[model samples]
Structures are given as C-alpha cells and as structure tokens.
Target: MGCSACLWLLLSLGCVWGMGRRARETVLGTLGKATMLRIPPELQNLTLHCGEAMWKRDTEDPQRKLVLLKYSGGNYTNFMQGRNRFHKLDFSLEILNTSRQDRQLYEYVVSKASEEEVWQIQLEVYEPVSHPSIQILSRVLANGSCAVTLNCTTERGDNVSYNWASQDLSTSGLCSHNGSLLHLSYSLQDASIACACTASNPISSRVVTFNSSECNYEHGGGAGLRTEQLVLLVVVPIVTVVVIIGVFVVARLAMPRASPEQEHSSLAEDGTLHTIYSQVQRVESPKKDPTTVYAKVMMPMV
Candidate 1:
C-alpha cells in the first residue's frame, strides 16, 4: 500500500507539471498594428514528424479555426486558410491591422499520430496613449502656502491610467491624488516645486510636467474676494447713494420759492375790490339831506 501511495504522488506531480506547461501566455498588441503569435520551440518541434497543426480563435462568438497545416513525407502543406489577413510564418502567426474586436483567446493545437497537444495565447489590443495635458483647476491660500488643485487629461487612449511624481512633497505638505486630479499645498518660498504626470496604457505611455510657480498667488490664492472687488462691492453703493443725494439737493436748489407774504400779496392783487356807495336827493328834498354823511370802509386780507 505504501508503494502504491508513492506512485500516486509522482503521478499527481506529473499531472500538475503538465497543466502548468499548458497555461496560456498573454500577448499585447497595438490597435491598427501587426502582432506575432509565436509558438514555443517545444510546440514548433512537434511538427517535425507526421504531425498536423491548427490554430483556432475563441471570442464572444463561436470558436473558429484560423489556419491548418498538415505535415507528411517530411513536407508541410497548407490545408486551410481561415482569413486572408492572417499570414502564416515558419514558427509563428502574424495578424495584420489588429483592432479592438480582434482581442480574444487563441489555441494552437498540434496532433501527432495518436497524441494531441494544445497551447493557449490570450491577445489584448489597446490604443496607444496620447500626450497628456495639465491644467490648474483651482488655487487658494492655506496657512502660508499655496494650495492648488490640478487636473490631467488625454485626448484619446484605451485603458488609460494616471500617476503623479513630484520632489520634496513632504516639505510642502501632505500630497493627495484621486485619479487624474492632484491636490497639493506648497509654499512659494520653497524651492521650485515641480510635478510630473504620466498617463499610460498596456501598450504605450505619455507624460506631462507642471510647475507651481505659474500660480498667480497674489490674485488666486486669496480665500475671499480681491481688494478691487471688495472696493467695488462697498464703495460703489456708497457712491451711488451720495450721487442720488447730491442730485436731490441740486433739484431742490434749482426750484423757485415763494414766501407767505408774497403769496398773500399776489392773491390780494388778483382778487375783486369792495367799495362804499352813498345816494343824495334832488333840491326838492334838499332840506332833509342837506348835511353830508361820512363812512369808513375796511378791506379783508386775502
């Protein structure tokens, strides 16, 4: 029973090794470029005898055979051509004009008499990373240093990621980052503060640099409004109120005025007059009113 157990352990180890040997390898490709799917020498040697080899592609669609070769009488012949764009080489397969749709798993199958072996290759295609650009999102004063928020961007890429690099970050303050946004609080007195952003993908990478000296600390660093804006906010309303008062005083000075005595005199001059009348008889009744009568009249103020 002990001897059988030893044999079983050896068999199990062999099976594990065999499985490891068949593990798929990953290959990266750039969009609109050509990539080679190279077969290892061990699998390439399998074609020396009366062996037949075939390549198959597996994707979201059904599995499809890419190419087939038959070796007989110490010679190889192409049995099938799956696609025109695929070029068969001595020890590898070349795919031209790779696209994102071409990313998938591929199997290289070799058959020799009664034995069959398979190798897998995973292909991933990506667009090359574009040049990155940096922009200052905002700036403010924190304590005595300038706190700035920066943003990095790229025009186009596939599976793109951003990483920032800087020097003497601890001297300024704790630096924090989130994806493409970087926040830093640094002092202007601190020697030149510079930061670099690297945008990368599986196939290509790009980098950009920014300097903190470009920040307009006097203008943007203030937590509140600027002096000019504050002056406008406060002084403008006061000036407007003063202007309105001056206009009212000038209007009052320009108008005509009349005193009570002048107004009363004007009214009396324009009003109707009052007079006293007396009648005397002729000489026949002269004796009765021979004596003259006098009367005094008073006028009322208007």
Candidate 2:
C-alpha cells in the first residue's frame, strides 16, 4: 500500500516517504546478464493506480541520483534508454547486461491515490572465476620440516575462495582469501607430498597442483601451468630435437654420392705413392761437359 496524504503529500513527509519497507532483498547477477528488480512478491499483485511514482538510486558520491523516474505523470530521464526497460507502473525494473558499475542500490516509490510504497534493491554483479594460478611466495627450512608459503590468484572473480589441500591427506594448511588472492602456508617434512590450490567463486572453480618438494611454481612456469601450456612446453623441445634430426638426415642424403669409379680411384690412391730419381749436370763453361751432378731420391709407400 502507498502512503496517503493527498493534498498534504508535499507538505507532509508521509506521502513522499513510503509507509514501510517490505523487504531488503539482495539480487545477485553475473556480469553481462540481465536481472529484474521488482517489488516484493507480496506487493506485486497489488493493482495500485498511482498518481505519482518516483524512483531514486541510493548513491554515496555526489553525482546525479540514479533517478529512474520522478514525476506524477510518470516521467524518466534519457539517462536510461536501452538499459532500463521496465516501468515502475508494472512494479518491475529490468536491467540488461549488468556490469560491475551496475552493482548498487536502487530505490522505487509508487503512490496509489494518495499513499506511496517504496522498494529498495541491492544488486551484486560478479564475474566467473577463471583458472587459478599458484606460485611459491616464500619457503624456509626449519628443523626437519620445510615451511612453504604459496600464493593463489585468479581473474574476473568475486568473493573468490581458496583452499589448500595436500595429497598426503594428513597435512592441512590455513588460507586467507583477500579479494581475488589466496595465501596459504604449509610445513612439510617430506618433499614427496603434493599440494593443490583451488580457487572458486559462486559461478566456477579451478584447481592447480604442485609438488611440496618443488614449490618453485611460477605464474606461467612450473607444474602449475594449464594443461595446454604444459603440453606446448613439452612438445616444443621434442619438435626441436626432431627437426634437428630431420635436418641432419636431409643434409646427409642431399650430399653428392661418390661414383663407383671415384670410389675405385680413392681406394687405389689410399695407400700408393709414386717415387722417381733425377740426375742433373750443369757446366759453367762450354769446355767442361759437366761441372756438377746432383741426384735426388724419394721413398715409395710400402
């Protein structure tokens, strides 16, 4: 029922102010989804012929009040064109493609005859959680146990939650969820034990695991990578090795082939060497037949 003061509607606060709040309801929506904010189900069926209806969004900043409509003749601003599609007469406000900016309080006031009713809606728009990444923040060895701390993070998530669980089934660690980050620390005496970090939101969840012994998990490195990334890392080296082997084989095959005649010649020259002796005589004057004679000898291959 709407508040009624008729002529005193402006002079008195009762007419402007809603008689009472039906319920403070929270509307949760995912980003880019459409959600409707309507009057309480109890008041939805009320067929109130309102003379004046005013809707104002409660805002903290000193900007234009997100006033959807404010007039006795049912007038709204051009601020809401395609976004707000529902009229308050039907007691429903439809918002499309809700975004982070759309998350706020919306107020609706409708007066029937002389009475006015108010509805306040709190909207929360969240994004689906993407894959979580876990990396070692710090590690210290104390006594026989190694104290390991890990950080988990994700993108496009709201009210994100994180849990650290161990494969040993005996080791449990405490974690804190601050915004989209999860911090966990564990004391492990055995390096063989493994731990997994799970990031979850109201919409989705993802898990990443790492060995407790080797907590050097980096953002995109280490065993914390997504399956495709790990696959690519493994395949790149194998492909490189294969390509090198292929190139070697191709080069060996492309080399010029030795002919049979060339092979025979190579074999014949492999161990054979020719040797010869030469004698020379030289005369300075025509009278002497020979002034000197020199002989040179060379050894042949055995």
Candidate 3:
C-alpha cells in the first residue's frame, strides 16, 4: 500500500498525485510540464490475472462519447504523435509538457479473468504569484516617533500572506494582524529607522521596504495625522481660556478706592460719577398792600 499522504505531493509550482488503482486520487500539475500519472507502481509485484488493459479519455460531446487512446493491440496509432509516449518496458503512459487543454479526467480500464477494475485521475493547473506592494496607513507622528501600518498585496498570489521586518530583519515592536489578512501594523519610536513587509504565496514571494526618515514629523502638520496633534490642538484653547481669566482678575484688582462724602462721590468701575447740592429762596409782597403782604421764605434741597 502507498502512503495516503505521500500520494499527493504539494509543490510551490503545483501538485503531483503518486498512487495506484486500488487507492484512486486526483493529480495536480503545472502547465507546460511533463508528469507521470500511474495507477499503482506496486501493482507490478501483484500476482493477479491480467487479461487486457486499455486507456481512455473523457469527451464533452452531446453523445458523451469515450475517446479511445492512440494505442491499440500493443502498437502506437498513426495519430499518436511524440507527445504521448508509451513505454512498453512497464506499460507506463507519459504525457509531455501538459497544457490547459490536457486538464481533464482520464480513465484506465482493465479486463481481468474474474472481474474488471477502472482507475481514474484528474489534473488541475494554477497561475504563479506576482510582485507584491506595500501601503502605509500613517507614516509619521508628531513626537518624531512613527506609528506605522503597512499593507502588502500581490497581483496573482493565491491566499497571500504578510509579515513586518526591521532594518536588521528584526521585530518592529508589537505588530498586530487585522481582520483583513492583507494588512499589518507596527509602532516605531525612531523615525530614522527602516522597515519592510514581506508577501508570499505557494508559487512566489516578494518584499517591500519603507524608509522611516522620509516621514518627517513637522511641528504644525506632518505628512500624515499623528497621535500627538490632538494634544497640540487641545492645548491652544486651554491656554486662551487661562489668559482671559488672568486678565479679568488683574483688571479687578487695579480698580480705584473712593469715599461716599466726596463731591461727585466716587467713580464707578465704568468711570462715571454723580453729584448732589442744597439751596434756599425768599419772596416779599408790595408796600402798598402792607396790611395783607408779608415776607415769604422757601427752602430747596437736591
């Protein structure tokens, strides 16, 4: 018996299923590559009755016809070119430089003395991965530190992965993975350091780097928003309110002191003053009406 797990060999380029008829399985191969799809190599040692064995292919015709092989009567057919060669030494079928057209289901029918057994195989192809790229969420911070976020992506990578690396290929300190499989985050204190991101797939891999020094943290506004800017924006309003309160307290202490008896009294806080006065008046009737006339006096105070 063949190792069930070894029957399928997964490679960076593709896959190959190496097994026999008793344990049938699918075989994966890359395009433009030759592969050996055998039923069971160990079967050669078996002492079973061998009547006749034939190879066949699946067709998409409306009749669901089965296409016979180019080999018949232990001789190669005229239509059988150099692509499909049969090695009479072990009766093995070799398909050379397989193409997309060759990705399909194939069968080998065997006729024995007691019963017949049919072996099947399937082939699949996949495209290789492409060059990857990196994207940073925030490149700079206000305090010269960098809270960096890098995202890696490839053009043709299947289920691609991402990882963060530093100048010496070390840790960038507390990196985290997002719900999105493509993105990664790192927090760096020194903006002068360098970092990189690696993206890979089964077929290929790529790496991209980011220069931390290029991300300068300007005092007012940096290349990207930083965590420290919130403090700067908040401090301005707080300082303004403090200055206004200080000015009010100083003005109140500088006001003048006055007494109530002084003329025009004392000046108000707004610099306005009010005053008060007292007076007396007298009146006399004509001498000719001396008998009915008398001196009259009036007093007025304000």
Off by over 4 Å in 1: 1-21, 63-90, 167-178, 217-302
Clashes of 3: 2
253-283, model 2: which lDDT tens digit per residue? 9999999999987775664443344444554
On the 0 to 100 scale, the lDDT of residue 179 in model 3 is 22
TM for every model, in the order presented, reads: 0.57, 0.50, 0.47
Give the number of colliding residue pairs in candidate 2: 6
lDDT of 1 by residue, 1-302 (tens): 69978766654443334332465899999998888887876666554432466666775647455544444445555543443133334446677678887788877776644555678899999999989887666778766678877777898999999988765565333433437888877776776676777899998988777665644632222323456667899999999999999999999999989999999978777666645565556677766855454444566655
Residue 81 C-alpha lDDT in model 3: 56
Question: Residue 62 of candidate 2: its Cα lDDT?
Answer: 61
Residue pairs with backbone atoms closer than 3 Å in model 3 (clashes): 20-39, 20-40
TM accuracy, model 2: 0.50
**C-alpha RMSD between model 1 and the true structure:** 13.9
Candidate 2 Cα RMSD (Å): 8.7
Candidate 3 C-alpha lDDT tens digits along 1-302:
45644432222112112223344568765556775666664332121224256556667664574544543345544234576766654555667877777767777655444444567777665444566655555444555444544555666745567766665535455333432122333344433555555666554557665554444432212323454566679977899999999999999999976557553433322243323333323246444333433433332322
**C-alpha lDDT of all candidate models, in order:** 0.68, 0.63, 0.51
The candidate with the higher lDDT, 1 or 3, is 1
Which residue pairs overlap in candidate 2's backbone? 2-115, 2-116, 3-115, 3-116, 4-114, 4-115
List the pairs of residues colliding in candidate 1: none
- The list of candidate 3 runs beyond 4 A from truth reads 1-22, 45-51, 61-82, 135-140, 157-187, 190-302
